[model samples]
Target chain A: MVNTRNMVADNYTPESVAEAVRKYDGVRRKQAIGSLVRSLHIDNIDVVASYGEDAAVIQNGRTALLLAADGIWNKLMEVDPYWAGYCAILVNVHDIAAMGGRPVAMVDVLSASDDAIMTEVSRGMHDAAVAFDVPVVGGHLHPDAPYNVIDVSILGVAELENIIYSSKAQPNDAIIAAIDLKGRIHPSAPMNWDSVTMKTSDVLRSQISVMKDLGERHLLTAGKDISNPGVIGTLGMLIESSGVGAVVDLTAIPRPDLDALGITFEQWVRMYPGMGFIMTANRSDVETVCKKFRKTGMAAQVIGTVTSTKKFTLVKGEQETVLFNFCEEGITNI
Target chain B: MVNTRNMVADNYTPESVAEAVRKYDGVRRKQAIGSLVRSLHIDNIDVVASYGEDAAVIQNGRTALLLAADGIWNKLMEVDPYWAGYCAILVNVHDIAAMGGRPVAMVDVLSASDDAIMTEVSRGMHDAAVAFDVPVVGGHLHPDAPYNVIDVSILGVAELENIIYSSKAQPNDAIIAAIDLKGRIHPSAPMNWDSVTMKTSDVLRSQISVMKDLGERHLLTAGKDISNPGVIGTLGMLIESSGVGAVVDLTAIPRPDLDALGITFEQWVRMYPGMGFIMTANRSDVETVCKKFRKTGMAAQVIGTVTSTKKFTLVKGEQETVLFNFCEEGITNI
Candidate 1:
């Protein structure tokens, strides 16, 4: 009796997990984003960075203005309008923070056919706005509509010299991921890992400020928040955007107890963690950056190392599998 | 015999026309906007101005960051997705320009049920982005949806000291309206005045730059773009926001052959002009400001004067009618 449950259960190879994540809908949907970006790209005088970054950086004198927008998924809107609305703001704030900026304000565009749905959405938006301390300024509202939709855009600010970008990762940098793993999967949505809602406002705010600190200190080379795509997929995106590659160790990826949560390793690697980020930093600064995130009550660990091969790979025990080959296939191709 | 036809049919009794415009659906729909604003207002660290203005302003160091989001009407989306997408970007750009800011970049959230609508909408967005030289960066896309909707948000930058706000008009200030009347009604939507698509990019760019000039010179006290609620309703919103009032001489409003367009005097005030702005300026600077707009190929005229009575009145030959009273009833109450 050689601890059969532990060995057999955790013995799943990396190739199987890699293939599933590569073919996941969350990752596949991103394939068309690049073409759409190319079609709409134009020369703008004030736009310092656009399609390739988390938020488009606009040069406004000595300050860099961050602008980004996110929409709630239709399925989420149908199941629960409140969560959808909360996530709309949640994702946008993450976008700004991922770029090492402080979110200042937000505007929303909401369309709803039902009054009950509208009220719930508003309630969620209000709760999130208050928690984040970012005002919901002005927006267009469609009161009577056949479908429900919520789109939110945020504006943030950072010093021009201190702003971090997604295209500056260097080879041999340590890849670190900081995630708040103190929450469980949402009862309504299996893929959603609820973390922020249950925490105090101070805790959430502290977690958001860690990125800004890293930006100011120039501790991180490149970064992105974990979104609909899970941890591994998000790292793939960061690597692709930086025109570099990464090799992530499966065991080092921070995760809650999958067995207790009734989820598998593969599913855990493909689910969106509500409050999580993937970042790259120099080996010398890794300890300082991770310590900053740890102070905010998040688990930070070195999950991988940036590489020059232009390919994303996953390793589990002695098995290794390629998730994406940027030379031929890209995540967003931004 | 009464010379009704020769006496300028467009210059009808202001009382009757005012009543018709007050009851129009375009204006009536705006009545709900105020309640929504009151519900959403929150305290933020950097938000300087929000609801009731064309764009929300946020303090970003020495600069003011402008953020705004707009959604196309459901009817317009059903009529033509292409025009709907085009208008989405067009209106957001106007929101920034109306605030005397330089537009930086935009992001859009598109919900479509099929590829045909998506293609058309994307094409329209592409055309406008290229024409205006504003890039549509990254945004959310709903590939399979129950309905079609397009919402766009923009980022802009303005000098903190020179930003034009909608709530600063003083009593006795001249109210000026500048509009491009050289356009036809859109074939898909009769209420839309399609001036931008017909003009060359050079002409539109110059027209947009006029607002910047006005801000830099401190020529205007308050300003806003004429949107779906049309010229008068937009003016009503501005006055309500400023907590002031105005009296308009209906005969002074610029119109392009109401007879040729087969529209009534009331209908003209409710039609959405493609390129138009309402500004409140000191009586002394009115002439110079109007001259600047006229040089940019726009028709500019003094149509009213700001008042302290907190009422918007439309006046004609020996007849007058009240449009809105900010003290008792508000348009957007922001």
Candidate 2:
């Protein structure tokens, strides 16, 4: 969520780690969401949920229609149009999958000042769409805009009973962290861990559908895809929406060789891996849920426990520190 | 359609009106569509239709889920932030409505460099969403992006049998034009006709549902909402998509007082009226379709005839002009 820190307490004090996460740009940017949602009115009775979930769920009898949109950050686009396009589709597909839905189709809105960038972006989008087996059906394009931006929206279908809502966490539920640990940081964007790109379509599809399986089995109480705000910040948003918090064990978070990768614990927690999830499950169901993710070749472990205290705390060895006090300041404040 | 003139052969040459519509920026900008769509592949069995419709129709059980995305022009965003925001929602709603579906919800991806523009844009979107009764359920925001962009995606639903298609216009069908004439040119953008802003939500809702009613009654062979390409260019796209031709009488087009508004007949014909539609219907059902629109306080007329030939022609008095020959060059070749 912030600056990298070594394992030693002397090198990374709990208070300092807490302060750095509080001041990170990823967490700070989410503050605008509260005002944006406040300005919108929910006049549609069919809209079952909005704003706080990864994707908005609309009622269609027993079928739930999932809709979500994601835009590439300008910096990300400037760094690599190909990755930007890939992430555009990736994030949108994740939004639907996070809701335990199978993505149907995607529509993109792209604006580019030049053809070279637009071609690269479209190529990236095409390759990712094919890899995920999701079609880019249709979209609008601004061929001569002054800047480059790619925004993608996906439609997914699921049963209403099977939705894995971010607001359904129970106080006693165990928080689980699942992430693919076999990828290197993207050469262009250091914050991204590129795990899906090298994987086959069959493997990637199975990995994504694990959430749906978990939902169908009702193993997880709540779940969310890890995004730009990273695991900790994403968890903050999820538990905040659930009106709860947690005490996380930093040492228990699933990780690769951090020292070998040359990324500190703080940065590792903040990195947006190509495939990752933060989920909550009942204590007895925790092993099965983790096993489901582990079967997809992802490392899944119990990282913490949901709490009624309305605060997020991190524990390492004998030291513990409060990361986010939901009762005071919250990420996304929704 | 172009300048109004006497029905005499010497009054208006076919080449002149053809030049006017062909030279329009709206029509010219759409030329990029063919290339963009060619780069995308649809592997999903559920996608019944895609690029050639107002909204891409996806099959699900007995229902049809409609998904469409639209991006506001940067020029519009720069000229009027609120209008751009409003149009973002307004246009997305129309895409669903044009496809004879009831819009359920919407998601937006917005990037604003400053607070004031963002606030105004959100206000515009909120007001439009409220008027249309569609919720802005969820979206992604780039709070600190370097540029301004507003892209919106909408979800709509309809019975599979009742979905209207842009690519289904039949030869010998009566081409109908419907538009609310009770509006002035928007103060900020000259090409926009401000119609919906002054109307009640009830009135606006009825105006939008006329197409739905038409669908239920099986009154239209094909349909498309009048967009930035104005009545003529939109019709060209519709006819091109349908693989048919059309002969539109210049005199029959619905319009406000061009002279009083101080805009020429040419200008009015190219304006994007806030509430307008171009539809092809059975010759016998044309009256019923027009009557439905007239009942909603919009002018409705049988302005054209669909033909087997792949050409669009305009007529006034004894003069006839070919607007577009789809067999050669076309607008949005998709």
Candidate 3:
């Protein structure tokens, strides 16, 4: 690994990184999920788990059904309707993949202010669906709504015994971050790292299936797709859900050539990667999990370790800082 | 049966009824679905049926997975956030029920301008989920969006042999309309018939199961829930999807006391029912199907016959008028 400690600008400190991540819009938006979950929560025998995972798990006989929904932010739609539509599918597919399930199909509810935006959004969805090899089966469309929005929901399936969960991390587990780093920042959204768009359909599908393989082999204890919250923020969510804490080595986290990309390490940690995941595995299985991800052209490394202290701490050589203390605050309180 | 011809206002005629339904906002909104389908359509080996069906069917082993999504209109959300949220679940449940599948769970994407709207919407969704016995497993919540919107998607399951489809109607099939008429018009929306709000969970579940029972008994040729397009418009959609036409006898259509409800026959025909369905069955099975629905406390009757003339017509005693000529115009055009 490159000496990222020396390459960091004088202003970039462990404390500054922690403070910047804590106040980010992407991370702050998640604060409302806790209260919303309390209002919508209801008991059902078939529901295996909900709220905290990437996708909710439902028991269907011997097979497990994964269900999830996501909506595109209005700002994304305004800046680039095409990319907005494309990411709607991209994020949903990751939800199921993060659960170690095979995404079977998707349905969408789309409303547009006009036909021009509608056509462009549909084209983006069509292209992404084709690239991922998942069909947009059916949906409702509001052709004349005063606002433009695209919300997509996906259904995926996996064996009941092979599903990964975000709420199963254990103390002493190795925390790993895997990211596809062979791409540039998205032109439309600087916080987005676009990697999947340049890859072939086969390559994209193969990369997604690695999570399923790792789950089947029983390598990872807990995992989640790196979403809008970026690497550290997303990891905070996972550990929060799992009722644990972690100490991350800032220098050990995988990254592209940040200096070459003309971005600081702070911005790099918060970018929503087009293809990435944060996972925890037993120390014995960490090597196997990293190797599986590396075989797919992704950067994978052990970045941290699960702790019982209930504090999310960051370290870089001698410098150290606490990003979040779950006992006091939460990323997604649910 | 009520002799409603004398109760009609002077302006209510076959021509007037047809013209009123043709220009309704609900029906007109559907016209855009045809072209939107063209843009989003992608072929997959596993999709059993889509586009024209209430719920898209996907093949998986010996079972069929039904997936569908619906969004509440902005006007409804603006008027009553609670009813809007409740209807979001109601419509999704009807989508799966119309397909003769058991709805397993649902996911939602909700965006609200403030906390009050979000709380009300979530409460509405919670109540509906409990009443329907389907769990709201997980969803995305946008607590600070500039607008309020709720989009819900459902996942249902059925044995492959018992799955019903909308594209299977045939010439000479008997057309039947079944509606629960034991309620009043909703105060929040005049065009909505509120049959379900007062019913118990057992009664509502029993009513929904009639379609599944009919499917298992192989009693219907094709069926669809009466949605925003109302009775005649929904029938036109089914027939259009099946590549056939139908002649509906307006007088034979079931209705509540129009004079007591203070609604004209034309307005009553276009009102969205809380629980209603229009279906086509073989002539030999018409009596059995109608009896099944009536036993569940719904109004059922043979209202018309499917035809191959490619023209949707309305007949009232001696007077007749063509409503939609499929050769030139279409309701949904799909």
Model 3: CAPRI class: high
Q: What share of the reference contacts survives in each candidate?
A: 0.67, 0.79, 0.87
lDDT of 1 by residue, B172-250 (tens): 9999999999898889998898888888888888898899899999999999999988888888888888888899999
- Specify the highest-DockQ model's number: 3
lDDT of 3 by residue, A260-302 (tens): 7888888988989989999999999988999989998999999
Q: Rate the local accuracy (lDDT) of all candidates.
A: 0.86, 0.89, 0.91
Better of 1 and 3 by DockQ: 3
Candidate 3 residue pairs in backbone clash? none
DockQ order of candidates, best first?
A: 3, 2, 1
DockQ of each: 0.65, 0.79, 0.86
Model 1: runs farther than 4 Å from truth? A1-4, A7-11, B1-16
TM-score of 1: 0.94
Instruction: Please state the CAPRI-style docking class of candidate 2.
Output: medium
Model 1: per-residue lDDT, tens digit, A96-197?
A: 999999898889999888778888888888888888888899898877777899999988889977777888889999999999999989877888898988
Candidate with best TM-score: 3
Error of 3 at A195 (Å): 0.8
The residue-level lDDT of candidate 3 at A246 comes to 97
Clashes (N, CA, C under 3 Å) per candidate: 0, 2, 0
